[model samples]
Target: MTDILGYRAKFGVLGPSTNTTVQPEMDEMRPAGVTNHYSRIIVDNANALSDETFLKGTALIDQGTVDAVRGVMTCAPDYLVMGMSAITFYGGAKGAEQWQSNIEEVAGVKSFIGSVSVVEAFKAIGGIKKVAFLSPYYPVANTEVRNFLSDYGFETVADHPFRAPTWTAIAEITHKQVREVVEQMNDDNVDAILQVGTNLCMARLAGRLEQELNKPVVAINTATYWHALRANGITDKVSGFGRLLEEL
Candidate 1:
């Protein structure tokens, strides 16, 4: 029999079908004996981003999540990770909790979701209370992120929204653009700089920014994966992603 690699843990990652960055970022951070398997929540239309359009897209994602969860469960993963962020951050902290509950109910497995993962990441990093964040979401979604963080007791010191034209455009955002947003958001009062939107591809950039800014620069993908590994009791301490994976 062929040797199966992920004898330690198999992570089932769920993302929107239109997202192009989460799977690649997760694969880049995969440690020895830890494998990542993906299942996409189908998004039939890639419409221009707006409050109305974004909410509609999230509804589609919600509709598709159960089926995607079912499909990934067939892999018999040791844990689950939600690679998308919007839905989890939609209502607030309570909304995130309910979303997780729904996932556990349907998938019959515990999972690491973006909203809760980021909160846990903050706690792991010494209970940082002030933060700056960047996102490719519309104004409404960004508000939800702020609300969710506020509910967790962290104050958003500053926020930058890319307002990417479409779901696909979120993946097209360049590292230079992301760096500029991070630079614009940073200040002495900001304890950390958070990059939301898994499709924004900020993992490596977050590491570099952390060195430059001398503070935590957390990428959602990195935080989500880190939460999964630690929650599963696999503390392999990955490098190059960010301090979340390396130190915490």
Candidate 2:
């Protein structure tokens, strides 16, 4: 039998333990009968981070993913939503495929991952060539995201990195902080701007900016969840987050 509230579809979402942003942002975008079940990949808050330490911390989160998957699989979710983005962008497009393939194999179901989902969103929206991005990650992780996007034939005209010192600090990034970065990255040559870190909480800002900037302001959480719903054949046309959900 299907879950009571999730009779339409139950998405098993996986993210780092220190993430407090993706869940709420995603819930606000959910359509009727679609429910989100989150399973945290346990990791101590990486407080005092540099490029080296940040890599180590993310490695810990990577190690915990399978256990998180098993925990969520108990609900028999119809699909998986990988709420983390850094790890998926680690080895470029081919590496993203392998990472997601492992998760899907473990969950025994189809899955939607953040990195690839954002690429799909760009494709659906069409004609997005040069791009810029902002991230809560250190330069190390940002390199991976750039590489992943480059693999998909998108060029990085400009990008910004917040290098949030702790996993929790990523969620602490303010709207003003993001807009400042957007202002810095905004260029006539860049057709779209993207925010990569899921915990950075940019979906709402992204949607609002698209109107103000007259360009696609793509947020990872919005892209991933929108990919999940659309790939599952649920065409709800969710609003508020961005055009990816509201129109495409």
Candidate 3:
């Protein structure tokens, strides 16, 4: 046995190999005593997203995900995180629960997926019924997310996606552009503003946007990390994100 029980507060993240935003977001959200590691799976390069592309990447994704967690399992991280939101949102509510259980079984450690963490954060903030969303994916990916959330019993009141073709473009998007997309999602009837793209740089602005919008504005990355920290009972107050993690 590697004896993972004796190490410090380390976390392992399973993310897309090309993802450029998950680490920065994790760094911003993690508290003083914690650290992070990453495992990358195949992802669309920069041109397009297609079923063929996803199919080609499936074996790589599965292998990389297992390898990432297994490698980190040596260090015995207290927790594991699935850093991609789309995969987390797959299979809906039933899928989310099974994924959590599967990760724990394979990793021999507690685990969380970004989408599940987002839902847990919503519950923590006492949000139910309805919410709005902003995404940086094409219509196909957008439909997947919508269906996942609806299956979880959350009404998708309204949503706007920028229809980006690749994850790299989503990560390369500037903060100013993200804020503009945020403006496009403004609605009076939605209970909150939810974003689901780890590639999107909405974490740093979560606090200010929530205050300005007068409702919870949850960046997917932020909520995921918040849920991880909370799941481990680590309650260090993280500022600059939003009231969800700061004042909750």
Higher-scoring candidate on lDDT, 2 or 3: 2
Best by lDDT: 2
Residue 63 lDDT (model 3): 52
Q: Model 3, range 48-140, lDDT digits (tens) per residue?
A: 566444434433554567766787788667788777776667678787788678778999888878788878888888856688888776556
| Native-referenced Cα lDDT, model 3 | 0.76
**Cα-based lDDT for every prediction:** 0.89, 0.92, 0.76
User: Candidate 2: minimum summed lDDT over ten consecutive residues — where?
Assistant: 46-55
Candidate 3: RMSD to truth: 3.0
Model 3 TM-score is 0.88
TM-scores for the candidates: 0.96, 0.98, 0.88
Off by over 4 Å in 2: none
Model 2 lDDT per residue over 20-54, tens place:
99899999989999999999999999764688888
Q: In terms of TM-score, which candidate is strongest?
A: 2
Candidates ranked by TM-score = 2, 1, 3
* Candidate 1 lowest-lDDT run of ten: 1-10
Model 2 earns a TM-score of 0.98
